[model samples]
Target chain A: MKYYIGVDGGGSNLRVALVDETMHLLREVVRGKANPNTLGIQQASDRIQQALREITEGFHEPIRAVGIGISGAPKAIAEKWLRDTVKAVLPFAEVVPSSDEEIALVGANGERRGVLVLSGTGSIAHGANDAGESLTIGGWGYLMGDKGSGYWLGMQALEAYIRHEDGTDTRPTSLVERVRQQCGFKDRFDIIPWLYQPAPDSSKVARLAPLVLEEAQAGDAHARHIVEEGAAELALLAQTIVRRLHITQPRYAFAGSLLTHPTPLAEALCRRLRLPAPPQPRYTPLIGAALLARLTVDPV
Target chain B: MKYYIGVDGGGSNLRVALVDETMHLLREVVRGKANPNTLGIQQASDRIQQALREITEGFHEPIRAVGIGISGAPKAIAEKWLRDTVKAVLPFAEVVPSSDEEIALVGANGERRGVLVLSGTGSIAHGANDAGESLTIGGWGYLMGDKGSGYWLGMQALEAYIRHEDGTDTRPTSLVERVRQQCGFKDRFDIIPWLYQPAPDSSKVARLAPLVLEEAQAGDAHARHIVEEGAAELALLAQTIVRRLHITQPRYAFAGSLLTHPTPLAEALCRRLRLPAPPQPRYTPLIGAALLARLTVDPV
Candidate 1:
């Protein structure tokens, strides 16, 4: 049987999947972080090789193509290394190496023809048109952009708490109390050390997003305001993508914990974007990568 | 003849001054960073000791007291260590230990009875009343507060640049070209590695404040708006201190490069606060520390 292999390499972990021409998942394996930036390109390559060997061990099928979507492997050097590694494993297979975001976008839409708004620790909007033109908006990370992201919401909550303490914001917010409880802050100044002691951790700050959402749902005006602002910023991202892509009634899919789950932030974002509902992703990123691999060998 | 010693220890450098009873500066010495947070308490103490020894070398007059204002030496342990270090250097002298901000406030007013607004890499307003009652507001650092600080301004500039690049912000501003020229960015995505590669440096971000100020003065609408917002926040800080202290017309002094220098940000701040002009500080923070030392020995 002819087969295609897909690999999803992220910062925290890696996933390898094998599928037939029909796009049916035949085997899948998971491993540790395979991000070339974090784990040197050599180590990342080794991990991918091991995963490929394991996934293709029992099957005597010829793999026509291999697709890899790796975080921090978008640069030319890393991409070259990835392609070469796949070639060494499956000499006859065509290699299609892309970024994790690209594979996710394609996977989320089940094709290369929709917009995907991701609001994880950071936020970004990626869209592709039928003509193969693609555009990305936002995703400037925690410092510059990521306006409607988890980090942004959590930061807003903390800012509100500080303003409340300083009497600079007298708008009244339950966020002060909620954040204090969540962080176990005995004193308001405790936040100083918590944030700055070992350097600001974006993931740690993003974790507070859920509390903000909870407070919003509990009818806290301040929290609700924060959520609305975040939603509006996120909506702007999607709107900007739709306009730039010139896609009418574009299919929008949501990624990240804050958007995939049912929450006030998600609801507000959908309402602002006029999305009736969050569209379900047709396939996992792994499957999407496999499809991309198949497309490389047999163009449709 | 009797003398008082004042030491100002900061993240970058340390300044020590010897003053007579009349607060006349006698001898002064400068050294490297003496902040206990960056340099351990022992090393910080050693730096202070070396500076003190040099400043008092030729003066045989009895040293009545020593005043010190060191960054990150506010904790009881660090404070106690600082006091002991001073006592060890001049056993007969009384030791008065306080934070850099407190000393700056007293130094700027030449007494512990006015408000001081500082807007460097971070921002804060600290005030002291005749009753010895002191209040502090808005020194939450870059993440949570420091709304009107240089770091805040630079961050806003970068955010604007990103928005402008992504076509999210259509506002006409010269910040894009300024930032590009300043950072030597070939592509907009170059900012990603610049910010996240070696971790976000608040000081490096703050270094961009001047470009924003220059653009604001040159009549860039976006840059002006950012400056105005920053100035408004700073004015709020001063106003809050005034109201809380019940000082009908308190003496206000500005510190930090952004405020101490003549810039659009400083001008807007003075205008918003209704100050005829930026008030000149009566003494430097080192002299303020000496004054505090004097106050400890002879009240009034």
Candidate 2:
């Protein structure tokens, strides 16, 4: 039986899985940060090897092909290292390394025509046409940009806290203390380090956005304002990507850390963009990569 | 000779003077931080006594009355305590002890009619009616509210630095690096202890606003934005004070830490107010207090 391998490398963790050509999950494995910036090429490659080995321990089935996806492999050097590394170790196979974004796009489209609005550690909106063109917006990072991401929303909440703390604020903002306690921050003293620290994962604090949103849902004006702003930006990104792909009437799907709940942010994105109820992806990005591997290898 | 004393007690230094009823300075003495919040009220009172003793040592003129300007001596209890303390030491005198704000107004107006804006270590705008009724706005405190104050502007600049340290930013934030270096923080590790260490004097950092304005005038957008925002707020405060006093045609003056030159915040304040000419105070707050001393003993 022909076997296929699929990899999804995230900012903080890596998830890999092996599947038969018929699409049954054979085995699964997990590892630490596999993004090249954090782990570098050598370490990422070593982790990949261990993941593949652990997943295929007992079986002697020859690996047919491998597909790997990364959160941000923006440069050519990163792609070259990934493709070469898999080829160097496997000895038996065809290897493909793509932006985790690319695999997510394919997964959302089901190899056809749909857009994927991603709001995870970062935020992005990308679409694939029958002719394969791409467009994006609002993924410029945290500063001088990034309007829709969790970090962007969190930063705004922090600004409100700061304004209130400094006394120039006419606006009543107990939200600062509310969020402070929620995030385990004792005072403004805790904020300076969080703002400057280069944590092992830049998205570590982003995980706190949902709690802030829940606060907003419970009628906190500041928290609600933050979520509303985030959603509006994400919606704009989706609209821009859809227009750029030239899909006059486009249907798209969204996935990522933001999809964990039917978040107010997600709800706002749909409402703002006027997007109808879109399908939510049932299978994980790894499952999508495995499906892609089966297609890329072709058939008899 | 009927001698009158005018004393300005500060956290850093105290300046006391023996002047004639005409408000001309005859003798002067200086001591250190008598505001007990910084040096304890007892030491502050002792410093006051020392400054008085040195100035009055060679005086044969009967000291008729004394006026002292002190921070933290708000309306009733604090004011009564300060007046009692000074009276106990120099019993043969009519003593008038009040807030630095009230004395600043009296000095700026020279025992006549006008408005005084105080922007010192903290910021507040206050005025007195011809009826002796007084009102104040802003200058709540460093933590509660002091919009357009030196400390407010300084905290705003710090927020900009925090943004730069987070890699999510793209703007040219070289100013943040320069400011951070001043505190000996190479990274976030040392920044923690340094930020939270005993009695963090956030005001020192605020003293950087004028420097920031200089940088802004030299084409730094961030600095310019900070100063401009502060200027706008100060102007608004001036307008608010005017509105409150129902002064249709008002003659106004300013005091405090932000009056320093070679910066845009003050310039912006003047420009936004559409002042056709520069308004420089003819006398300092001490002189203003002396005028108040003369008025308190005014034989109306």
Candidate 3:
């Protein structure tokens, strides 16, 4: 009997799983951030090794392969370094490494023949054609791009709040009060110190996306406009991928909190894309990593 | 003859000038950044005092009055602290402090009666009516507003560059190459580290604004679009001020590099606002600070 190990190394946290050849998750261990970009290579390697050792120590069976889906590890050098590091830990097993987004696409559809739009802290659209050729759009991070992302929504909300506070925006919005209540800010100037002092956190700002959605549901025109625009931006991302890949009636899998929420952002996105129905994700990206590991040793 | 010290305390640098009642700059000294928001109140005060002492060392005349225009001194507390600090340094001088925008308006129009649109690292529209009542429209800093400012333009250019880099945008732009050359960055991922590592500097990012202008002048459709959008946003700022203040075809004064540049951004702004002519600046903000000091002693 053979087992496999799969690791999901992301910006926020890391997850490692022990799985059987059938791609069933047997035991999983979660750790803090293990992205080599944020955490140094040594730290990331140590965390992955620790997870692998802990998960396999209880089970004496030799693992067939180890697969890792790391955020920001798509480049050749990054992949080589990561593969070498993972190989060092599980010397007997085959180590395969890929980008977090690629694994997400595989996880969403069980096969690489659909589009996956991940809209968590940042946003990206990933698609794979029937021939297994893959492409990505709009995962450029927060500084340059991340349209329709959590950070984008938060920024739009902040802009609306500031404009309203200034009494310059003729367009009415309840965002000032909503944001003030949400952020626990008593004065408008408080936002200035809050945003700049701590060196803006992407996740911290992304947390405000739900506030915008909530306000939109409550009938705030500005909030609704932001949601619509965010949906449109995200729809454009999906549309671009679909058109570029020449996929006919591609099935779209929704990922991240923006789509999973009770808000209309996802509905608006699907409507903008003119999809016939909502597509459900087949599995989580972690399970997708496990599936990829299964395919490494036992390709059918 | 009595001398007045005029201080223009900005985010990037500070300028101090010893002037007579005629508002002619005598000995002038430039120092490092002195915005109380960026530099603490103590450090900002020390820099301002150092510049004042350096400029007035050779001439031993008692300064009758001193005027200061600080970037973030509009708040009552900021103004009071600055005034107290200035008074402590110049015991015999009557100290007056105002927002940087107010002094810019006074400096550009030669009086406090017209609108001044400043589009530097940040942007704002400030105006003083005939009743000496002042109102401001869009000085909400970089995070919330400053639509047509250098920082805004630079961010737009970066967004365009990222979109083009991702192949998500069909519109061709030289921004990717132009920005790479300007920033001396060989890899695309370098921008992420450069931006978030040291806490993003608004001015450093703003330095890229000229590249967008250069690209636009060279006829890049994407760059041109960004410039046009920026111009329209700025025109809205000006229009808001005009309607709120009930100014009839108000003579508009332009301050800062966005408008001062040879690009069509300013012309576009003016055209959008339906302005017939560009209002010439009567004096620099330093002289405007001096004139404001003159007013402190001899208010009409």
Candidate 4:
């Protein structure tokens, strides 16, 4: 009875799964963040090692392979660390490591042949073609890119509020009052210290995306504009991937809170991309990693 | 020969000047950053103390007053720190502390009247009226505002580069190659690591503004549009201050690298504001601080 291990190492949390040869999930373990960029390589390795141990604890069947999909894992250092950690834990197991985004793309399509658009704290698009070629677009983080992301929407909302307050905006927005209420801001200047208290936290800012979406659904013109612009930016990402990959009528899957959670942004993005509906991912990233692990040792 | 000391505590460096009762400069000393926000309060204080000791060395005339104009000094804690630091350094001297912007405003007009528009790493407008009432507009830092700032322009350039690369932007730009050359980017993905090396530095981003302006001057439609939009945003800042203060035909002054330097952006801004030329400041900020120091003890 051959078994395989799959690790999904995200920025916020880590998930590990043990599966049989037929891809049947036998056990699972969840732990803290394993993103080397944020958690440090050593800490990420420790988390992955601990999760692997817990998931494979009682199983006596020799693990055939281990697949790790970690955030920023595509970097050589992170990939090396992941491979070394898996090898250390499962001495006889073959290791396959890739970025968390890659696993998500594979999981979304149940194969490596579709486009995945993710709009979490940051936004990015990844597509894999049948010819074993993959392309990425717009994962530039908060400072450089992340267009149509939660952080981007939240930033637009805050900018609108400031423009409205300063009387510099031609288009009036209710964001001034809405943001004030949402952020519990007593004075307009309160936002300065709040934003830069220590430094800009992308997650904290991303948390504001829901408010902007809610306001858009509530028929606020400015909020609706922000939502539409964000959706358009996201659509551009998907379209660029489709064009670059030369994939005709590619299946598009959505990830992240803004896209996955039934919202106007998702609808707007689908409309822009000329899709009838948002495609659901076939499996979770951990499952996708398991399938990849199976492919590592038994490529069919 | 009673002397007054003026401290101009900027983000990058500090300037201290000794002036006579008539505001004649006697001696000057330069030091490292004295901004309490960036440099610790104790370190900023120590820098000020050291500058004071050095400037007053071999001088016998009793120091009458000290004026400090520091970045972020308008905040209560920062202001208190400045006061205490000055009092400690010059026990017999009266201390007058204000924000760097306030001192620049005073120095630009050489009085407590008129508007000063500064477009450095961050953009802001400050104006004072006859009734000693002052109004501030649009100094919301890099994330929230700084709409027409050096950081703002540079960020726009980077965004344009990404959009152009991703084929998401409608407007064509020379920024792709220009920025690649200016930043020495080996590959497009190199920008991501460079921008987030540790965290986004506003000054570093602001340094890219010149390339953007140069591109605009050299006939890049997208770059020109960015410059025009930036100038318009800055004009809005000045216009808001003018309207709020109800000061008809207010004298305007410019400061900071982007504005003070002869650049197309400055010309665009002046054109937007309908100014014939950029107004030069009547005195430097350090001299303005000395003038304020004189007014603190001898209010005439």
Candidate 5:
């Protein structure tokens, strides 16, 4: 019997799974901060090897292949770390390492042609064709271009408070109360000194999306407007990626935790695409890696 | 006949006007950055003296009442600064100093019982009844609260770009191009380093209100929504202040360069207030200050 391993490394957490030739998730393990830049190559490799050994200790069969999908892992340093670390741990296994986004797309729809829209700590759209060609639209990170993502919304709320507080822009949003509370802030003036303190985690921003969506759902005009606009933008990104990958009427599967929530965004995507939005995929994109391990595609 | 001087000291510019007893402006002088905090008290004081000297340099007559409206002058420090700063320069002039917003309100209306909404590099709403009692709504400053102001709008645009670029928030706003051009920022990642730098003026944020309003005017949807919200918020503030000031049917006077643009905020305020939108006053708020300076009123 053959065995396989799949790993999905993201901004906040890392997920790993072991499966037999049949793509079922036999066992899994989770860890914190697996980004090579964050944990350093050797340490990240050690963590991965330790986790994998703990999960698949007594499987008598040789490992077929191991696939890793990691955020911020495209850097040569990251890739090398993955290769060296995995090689040292599971010396007998073939490892196919890729971006966390890439595996998310595969897991979202399971080898079917589709677009994957992801929004959590950050936002990006990735799609793959029947042929391996893929493309992306916006995934610039919080500083430049992750519109409608978690970080964007949080920062946006801060902006509104500042404008209102500063006597320049006056837009009342129900999210203000939550925003101020979450930031441990009382008013806009505190933001200058506070934001200057340190580089906060990218995922911290997404926390506001749910509150904004709930307010929108509850008939807060500002929240509703924000969701509608955010949806339109997510749709634009999905559509752009679809066009880029020559995916006509592709089945898109959303793979982010944000997608699981009933945001106007996914609903808007369905409306924009004129296709029924699939219920959140039954499994996570990490499973896509397991499925990859279970595949019979001839590697010619 | 007696004469007096009124000065509007803002972050970027200063306007000093000399007026005769009937509140007629004789002449004026303009300069820069007289906010004691931004430009130190010495530097700002020098500019203030320069402005007063330029406006009444050759008059050779003592001004009966000199009312200088300075921006960023908190009440606690207003007295000491007024005693030392203004009096130091114009020994022959009686210096009566108040906040820039208060002076702007008096400037916007020749002599009226109502609310004055000032939106410039910052925003604040202050209202006074016939009894001389007053109340304030917004105008916390760039760090805490300044709703319906320019700085808030600019901050919104910058955050939108960051969200979009990072792929966290998926909303697409016209802010993409506007922020790029305004900040000359190349992309989302480019902002990471710049965000760590030191910036004192919140006026930079206020600068984006017009740009936001313009985009809304062009129907970018999100931009328009923000403008509408901004307008509505401004109206709410006006109404709040009006209620607090106990003026039932007061004329709503608005000042600030933002009013010069085609902002729906005024209309929104009209809608929110359920009152016909008043015209931009016959004279700017600075002129109103000139009127107050020329005529002395001591609740007789």
Candidate 6:
């Protein structure tokens, strides 16, 4: 009996798994970051290779296939490098490569035919219809897009705090105090220096998203407005994907901290999107990658 | 005859003028940039001193006073340093230091009152009422504010182009092709790399503002909306300053490329913020600085 290999190369960590033909997980291994966009291709490939080796150790039979889903690795740029690296590691196996978003979609639905909306440090809604047409919206990063994301919420909170400090804002918000307490800012305007630093970290800003939700939960109209607006933006992404794919009421799944965490923002998104109910992912991204590998080798 | 000096230390260049007691200009000199906020205090001071020396080279009479309106020099931080530096340069001169905004107001109205709205690389509305009370709105820089400025218009244009390329934007615009021709971009998505560089230059992005105005002139609905929104925001700044300062029909003056340039955006701003007519600045910022110096020496 031959096993299959699947890798999920994320921004923070690299995850690899060995699975049987029936999609049963045999073993798993995790390593450091492998996001090619941030971590150069060489480092990402090294980590991917390391994870694969650890996962397939002690196996005599050559793996039948290997599939990879890497963060920031679009098909045009990452496909060749990822395929060659996987082949070098497992000479006998066929390789399938794709973007992390695609993997997330395949993983959540156990197939590539449903929508996956993510609202973590950034946000995007990606999906493909039965006709194999895919569409994406609202993943334009913090500077250009990523509306209704954690970074967006944090930016909103910061803007509000600034307006309040400026003494021009009419809205009453405890968000100023909450942010000061959370970030340990001695002065209100201190947030400016922190934000304009030479290299502002997106995740550090995204972390502040919780404060907005906390204030909203406590009935702050300003914070509530931010949440509602974010939810609407996310909903627009889903609606756009569905309409463009020409799909009728396609199954939708959620991913990332902003959506998965306990917050009014997530609930508001659900309500605005008019989703029938909250849906759970059917399988892990690794499992989905393995399934994709199986499909690549044996297309029915 | 006693002479008063006024200096306009701008972001791009320095202008110094020797004005007599009656505000009649004696001699004017121009030099390189001396904005202390970006150029260190020492460099800025050096440039200021150089300009002063160049302007008063042949004059033997000790200047009676010096007034400076400098960009990036808020009174709270720049007061002591500027005063000390000017005193060191002109031993007998009484020195007055003020922000560029204040100087702009003084220069535009030939008085210490009325609003001065600027829309250059960044945007801000600043002025003082009859009561000597001053208010400032916007000018939060490119990252957080400056919503109605040239940089903002450029950013908006780029966003529109990206969205249009993504096949998600509802509006059809030729801005994509225009931006490509103007920016020398080979691929549609090449803007991503340019924007996400290690230290993205705000001025470079701001330089794209003219392109937006060009498109707007040709009657692109999407471009028109951006211009209108920008105008409304600038109008809000004027309104905020007017209401906060408790002035009725305060004389409003415009400065910077977004306002000074002949564009629909400037026209829109003028239309949205109704006034008697387009008001010209009574004097240059350097003259305003001299006037301020005179006021310091002789109140009222």
Q: On residues A242-276, what C-alpha lDDT tens digit does candidate 1 reach at each position?
A: 88778876778887778888889889999997878
lDDT of 1 by residue, B187-248 (tens): 86788888777877889999999989999999999999999999999988888888877887
List the candidates ranked by lDDT, beginning with the highest. Answer: 1, 4, 6, 3, 5, 2
Using TM-score as the measure, what is the rank order of every candidate, best first?
A: 1, 6, 3, 4, 5, 2
Tens digits of per-residue lDDT, candidate 3, A65-180, equal: 88788876773557787678777778888887867877777778887678888888899898888766778878877765488999989988887877776666867678768788
lDDT leader? 1
Candidate 2: RMSD to truth:
9.6
**Candidate 5, A230-274: lDDT as tens digits:** 767778788777766777667787756667566665676577767
Candidate 6 Cα RMSD after full superposition onto the native fold (Å) = 2.1
| CAPRI classification of candidate 5 | incorrect
Report the error of model 3 at residue B111, Å: 1.0
Candidate 4 vs candidate 5: the TM-score winner is 4
Off by over 4 Å in 6: A183-189, B184-188
Clashes of 1: 0
Q: Is candidate 1 or candidate 2 better by lDDT?
A: 1
Q: Write the per-residue lDDT of candidate 2 for residues B70-90, one digit (tens) a residue.
A: 765554536776677778767
How well does candidate 3 match the true structure in TM-score terms?
0.93
Higher-TM-score candidate of 2 and 3: 3
What are the TM-scores, per candidate, against the unseen true structure? 0.96, 0.56, 0.93, 0.90, 0.61, 0.95
The lDDT per prediction is 0.84, 0.67, 0.79, 0.83, 0.68, 0.81
How do the residues A1-300 of candidate 2 rate in per-residue lDDT, one tens digit apiece?
A: 788888888556788888887768888888887876657778878888788777777868788888788765642336687777777667687786666666676666556356777887677666667675654444444332356677666666666665564443546655777767766777444554465544222365566666667777777787788888888767766666666667887777787777445777777777776865545774567876776676667643
DockQ of 1: 0.76
- Residue B271 CA error for candidate 5 (Å)? 9.7
Off by over 4 Å in 3: A75-77, B58-61, B184-188
| Model 2 residue pairs with clashes | A70-A100, A143-B168, A143-B169, A167-B145, B34-B44, B36-B40, B107-B288, B119-B256, B119-B257, B120-B257
DockQ for model 4 equals 0.69
